[model samples]
Target: MKTVAFVPIKLNSQRLPHKNILPFGDKPLCWHVINELINVKQIDEVYVYCSDEKIINYIPKEAKFLKRNPNLDGDLVKGFDIYKSFIDTVGADIYVLAHTTSPFLKSSTISSALLKMIESNYDSAFSAKKVQTFAWFDNKPINYDLNDIPRTQDIEPIYVETSGFFMFKQDVFTKHQRRIGFNPYIQEIDEYEAVDIDTKEDYEFALKLIKTLNENGREQHV
Candidate 1:
């Protein structure tokens, strides 16, 4: 089956302004995930959907580039719209949605998720991180209560969508109008790989983590 990976990027970020082009490791932040996608053997093609021409220079020649619609450039624009636009314009049997913020995501993880989704006949698969800690909602206890608090280890794990990556068939998106389908598989990833840079502190933390990983000769895992 033909698979295409899409990395949606915009120059303007509300929390961290111009974060996509920020210096990260050896190159721009977005390049980290972009390059990772290019290395995925399961992906037949990689594309960057962005409004900024400045990013064109950084994108590798092997990946295709498509300019996003101006109307959809605003921060308030819904992500579903952008995704649907891409599906309509650039057709593919399977689509992989990868985020630039998830710089630590490994190519192996991407390949593994795709393999599982295809082999298991799952409609969709998304990268997530498992959390076993107590949770709360609206002042009420969730996953735990004061009356009978379960040990952290014994607590049922809750998977939090890390937005690291999403693999889905074109029909899944057509039916749900979302990246996730009715029957979706949660592909758990390590905490390090789930790091998403959305703020200044997150960016700094990622940089430090990258430095530490490199110093320990573990950069290849990224």
Candidate 2:
């Protein structure tokens, strides 16, 4: 399949100003996911979709740069708007939507998600974290009984979707105008791989985590 992956990012950030370009470790925060995507063997091409030309310097030479409309960079613009614009610009059999905030997402994990969507009956697959602890929604207890309480592990696991990545067939996205499909598969990821650096606290914590990973030889090289 003609698989193409893209990382959608902008200079304007509401929290942690310039978080995308800020140094996460040796490289910029956004560089990690881009490097991982570039290493994916199944991916035919990797593109950094950003409005700022300066971002070209931050990304690796292997990945192509696609300048997008600045209007889509606004915080108010929905993510679907960016996907629609990019999908219209770049034609592909498969589209992998990745984010700069998810620096710890691994290439192997990404490859697994894409492979599942490609080889199976699943139309789309996205990274998620499975939580077995007690959860609540709208003042109502979830995964628990009012009369009886169960251990955290005994409770049914709830899958929480991460901003890590989303892979979908072109037809599924174009036809439904959504990243997810009717037959979606969840790619469960560990807490370490599920890290998303959005706020200042998140960024700080991620910095420490990356350092620890690298020290422990857990970091994968491209």
Candidate 3:
């Protein structure tokens, strides 16, 4: 299918300043995602959405870049907004929203998600991890309490949101203006593969994980 990967990023970070440019393994964190997306044969185009001229300049000249406006560059703007703008501008058959922080996510992971969406006729799909913990809210235990019998597997599982990737049918996004449209599919990703870096700690952890994978000879190349 004609799929375009739109990766939204910004130089003005809150928790970890310029975390996208930070070194991870041998290259910048953004390179990992870029390489994977670019290598994926199913993807038609790879677009890096950002406003920072310096960041945009640093991106590989080989890959296509879409310079975001200053209004879309601010921290207040939600990721969905940036994604919607790209859809409106490009109008691809399939739009994949990927995060630069998720360097560990393989091209296969992305391709599989999109394939599922296409095969099932899903409006949109996003990566997530199945959660089965004793959730709590307002200092009160939710889902299961001490009084209830412990049947962890039987409990209704919650899909923990992983901002790794999202696949949307271009027309659905144009009509709905949201990633999670009416008919959404949640692709369950492995806990180990769901690495989202929003802080310095998250960044360090991801690097360590990548290093460990490399040390174990499990590192993959695009």
Report clash pairs, candidate 1: none
Off by over 4 Å in 3: 56-62, 138-142, 145-147, 220-222
Candidate structures ordered by TM-score, highest first: 2, 1, 3
lDDT by residue (73-186, candidate 3, tens digit) is 777887778877877787588888888877778888887877778788688988899888777779977777678757888876778778888888887777777777778888
lDDT of each: 0.88, 0.90, 0.79
Worst 10 residues of 3 by lDDT: 53-62
Candidate 2's TM-score: 0.95
In candidate 3, residue 217 scores what lDDT? 89
Candidate 2 Cα errors over 4 Å, as ranges = 217-222
Each model's backbone clash number: 0, 0, 0
- Candidate 2 residue-pair clash tally: 0
Number of the top TM-score candidate: 2
The residue-by-residue lDDT of candidate 1 on 1-222, one tens digit each, is 889999999988889998998988778888888898999998999999997777888766787899988777887899999999888998888999999999889998888889887788788999999998988879987787689888889987788999789989999898777789888888899989999999999999998998888998875544
